[model samples]
Target chain A: MTVRSGAAARSGARGRPGAGGRPGGVARLVVRTVSEVCVTAGTLIVLFVVYVLFWTGVRADSAMDGEIGKLQDQWSTGPVAAGTPGATGGQPSGPGKQPPYENGKSFAVMYIPRFGADWSKPVLEGTAVDVLKKGLGHYGRTARLGETGNFAVAGHRRTYGDPFKDFPRLRPGDAVVLTDGTTWFTYRIDRRPYRTLPTDIGVIDPVPRESGYSGPGRYLTLTTCEPEWGHSHRLIAWAHLDSTQPVERGRPSALTG
Target chain B: MYGWIWRHLPGNAWVKALVSLVLVLAIVYVLFQYVFPWAEPLLPFNDVTVDRGMGAVR
Candidate 1:
């Protein structure tokens, strides 16, 4: 009986070690748990980066396409007829008489031939996050299209399809073409890209003091985040009214060239 | 830590494994949905923009 009891005690001792109550065993377990947590955190960060860089672009492209389709449908219904007041050979309408554009609504398409032959994006009203997610967003209180003030627009430089990723490539004399289903307004790039602070609302002023223009005139301001992947500052390109042509006149030489 | 959990858990190895998986999943979900979002502002991701006045400077 003594021998049998000793055997039982030995078995109990073995089982206790396997139960992980020993100090070394606990330490190993703690290390393993911490490693697992680190692995999980790393994976989550990678997933977030993928969502921000790729998934957001996919979503924005689809949204912009849909907005463009709607705008084209509206234009095709009856507004494109020749001799319409707004469609009359791209003449700039009087101040405050341009076609009404609703906030958060897409009203035009912007094409940058210098960016790419097929580089086109919808221009929506308002610079809000939601509006920008769809495509280029117009500063709400800025000048209307082809107006005698700064028709300022903003787009993301690195995400949401990165509509202005090639903004730095723009040079003086490059054309920034905009169309509102009736008239094609072409603005000649007048100033190279320059950096500015985010709070510089004057960049979109009727007469952008920074553009070296002391008097009010027709202007266009294209703004985007600088440093490609960072928004620490804004990169702006200024343009002046070059010409206007009706859509019925076919694609402009700036677009075709 | 795992050994203590293993000894305290009821049932067989399968039960312990299932319980551990559930615990891990709950921890991950809480960290992602609550902890990470709450900690975002403390990070530098959204610190890109500066609110200084508009001056044309690089």
Candidate 2:
């Protein structure tokens, strides 16, 4: 009888508690389930908020791009108005010149369709302040757009919500469309990662590491802060210009007049 | 009356704590995910347009 009683007590302890049965156990379960639901809901809410904030930043950036796009369009098609002067050339430098940037800070804006409309930013002339503020900047001596040389463009990777948000996704053979849209230039990704300092002026040199030039095959280099804000290295995406297409105003394919 | 009182009370301390956490989380989730979006546009800078051209030097 004693042994039977001990077994019965042990059975009750194991059955109701260990086996997940009992009114109190049900109550505990209800609490746990509700807690889990709350945590999951909270996590989702935070994620959604983050997504919304990113969307807002994207919109603001797009608005800025729109204004710059207008100016680029005018400069691309509109006449250089016959021999415009330097920084003093009230007339547009007409393409290869230091893009008509304000304050000695000329910039070329590169827009990639696959990267989204807002991916556009001022290409600063040599990673300077004035240029970074406006957009991605072109290396001063790198091959000018349309020229058969290495055209290097650099931008911030993390700050300002990471302008190159989708850059890491670019694959070889991906089409990178750069336009003032009048002079549409396409570059195919070719090179792998190359690390260099802000002052490594030679990295953007026209001659690309002895890659025998096919008569200055138009090349492109994209530089951004590496590993995010830490900037311990520079991420470079290199490509060769595949083709160019001209946009006629009021045309169906042109982004604008 | 006694049974009703017991029903209203949580089964244990852990259950009470869990219920409290759940309630708090639900309130936070509703406020941020649903309510905040509706309220964001009302903020002054929320829609304030930034004129980038303003920084362009003549």
Candidate 3:
């Protein structure tokens, strides 16, 4: 009877029949638990570290972009702010006259409500590492809204974890919204894909050889690598600026809420 | 991490060591899969930290 009782106690302790005969079970469990914790902590730490590092670059770039926008706004409104007519300070009045670069922390994300989880990643800037990882970057040289040329923004397609993983799936009539809380700009996809090398200037030509554009029309050329995995060709999506409004007012009607 | 667990788990040690390693890995996996997401928002590496300023006052 004593031997049977001992066997039962051992099994109960290990939760496996006859397992209590194993020595130091509790201690082993504790050690295993600690090791598991260490592994998990290490993984989380690595992920967090990478996220933080890139986040700083993202914030800085956003802030700098905001600053540039403020400066441009001041310059643009300076003449009006001073109540002067044609206060053009000998500066050209078109895309060529505008500053080649802008800085501002204010950026609005344009999401295609139509796309589901397929369009989850945020737009980041530049094809470069620092910018592509965070948020989309407006081409430093592209024209601004209400302008007469192809203003462009380029981003990575596959590398750096592919923020634009599904950009290739974009179809005609996708809506893009740019915002700074106070102002929101809506653009509609009017143009389809155009392939070119990064250095191909003709791809960004204000007027394509085939398409005739007249008057001052706002345009957007979103460029990324062609195909999903390779950079042999550049993929360009063209859109015309539809309207500009305050973000507080919500999305434009063309975007269908 | 599974990698870490696989690395640290005993191949040469007795059952005691292997059990110990397994327990540790389970704890870590729990912390990673369940706790890490919540903790992420509070970590020091957060881009949007508590301080609202860009280290400069207006």
Candidate 4:
């Protein structure tokens, strides 16, 4: 043991000349510094993963619930508060003509029966990162809720509350329902989940190119990451407006049933 | 590295340990509140849009 220790000490000293002339001084310092940096980096990565996987979901879920609660409060009252004009007690004229939705503002609540009975999420106006962290985001360019053109929305498939965690489970003839406080819009899925490149912006077009959609209609485009936890591609689902009912009537059959 | 931090800490053994823990906790809080939230969007997992721009805020 002593001989081996002596040999190691001598070798370490020879590894760095003029390094304090102390045995194993420079080599040990270099190794220690490298290892310490690596350990620190490894720990930071773990912490970041924890933040993305668990912390973001926790905060996002509460944020979504808060948005829903506030929208409900607005509904219980008469007209929606300012910043959301044209939120009337009367019937909607149709898509393409309505008050402009405030950016980062939640204007509706969405539900998919295929996801789960209790599943619900707020639909925000813009598809900003901050907005999506709270709830699903409406593509600014698409049609409004239940509008004639495509009303597209985006959501995280894995993190940020996992609004689209069950997106793949969506199949043809499934129902996607939404209520903008004044009206209940029920949209029926037209096809199964379609996987495409992220660059395929046509998926959210007025009549999505590959959704088997032939012409313009009251379409709904739902987009999320392709893989469960990665973003190498996009998963899309298209739906057509099936029916509409005034909020005063009650929840839509798609929800109650 | 931890030993260096412990040596530099101006306190008794227990106080030093407590300070170290507090420092770590403080760092984690900052990361969670500001750093992680900002850096998260810069990463790819949050990309749900159909646009091709990687980590695009759009």
Predicted model with the maximum DockQ: 4
Model 3, range A90-132, lDDT digits (tens) per residue?
A: 2225435533433422233545554452332333333233444
Off by over 4 Å in 4: A1-21, A80-96, B52-58
TM-score of chain A of each: 0.86, 0.57, 0.54, 0.84
Native contacts recovered by model 1:
0.18
How close to the true structure is residue A157 of candidate 3, measured as C-alpha lDDT?
55
> Looking at candidate 3, what is the lDDT of residue A24?
68
Which candidate leads the pack in lDDT? 4
> Which lDDT values do the candidates have, in the order given?
0.77, 0.55, 0.52, 0.84
lDDT (Cα, 0-100) at A177 in candidate 2: 64
| Per-residue lDDT of model 2, residues A165-204, tens digit only | 5667777776666655345566677655555544444445
Ranking by lDDT: 4, 1, 2, 3
Cα DockQ of the candidate 3 complex: 0.04
Please list the residue runs of candidate 1 whose C-alpha ends up more than 4 Å from where it truly belongs after superposition: A1-21, A78-94, B1-58
Interface RMSD, one decimal, each candidate: 4.8, 13.1, 13.5, 1.7
DockQ, model 1, C-alpha based: 0.16
Looking at candidate 1, what is the lDDT of residue A235?
86
Root-mean-square deviation (CA) per prediction: 8.0, 12.1, 14.3, 5.4
Residue A100 lDDT (model 1):
51
lDDT at position B40, candidate 4: 89
My TM-score estimates for the predictions, one after another, are 0.76, 0.49, 0.48, 0.86
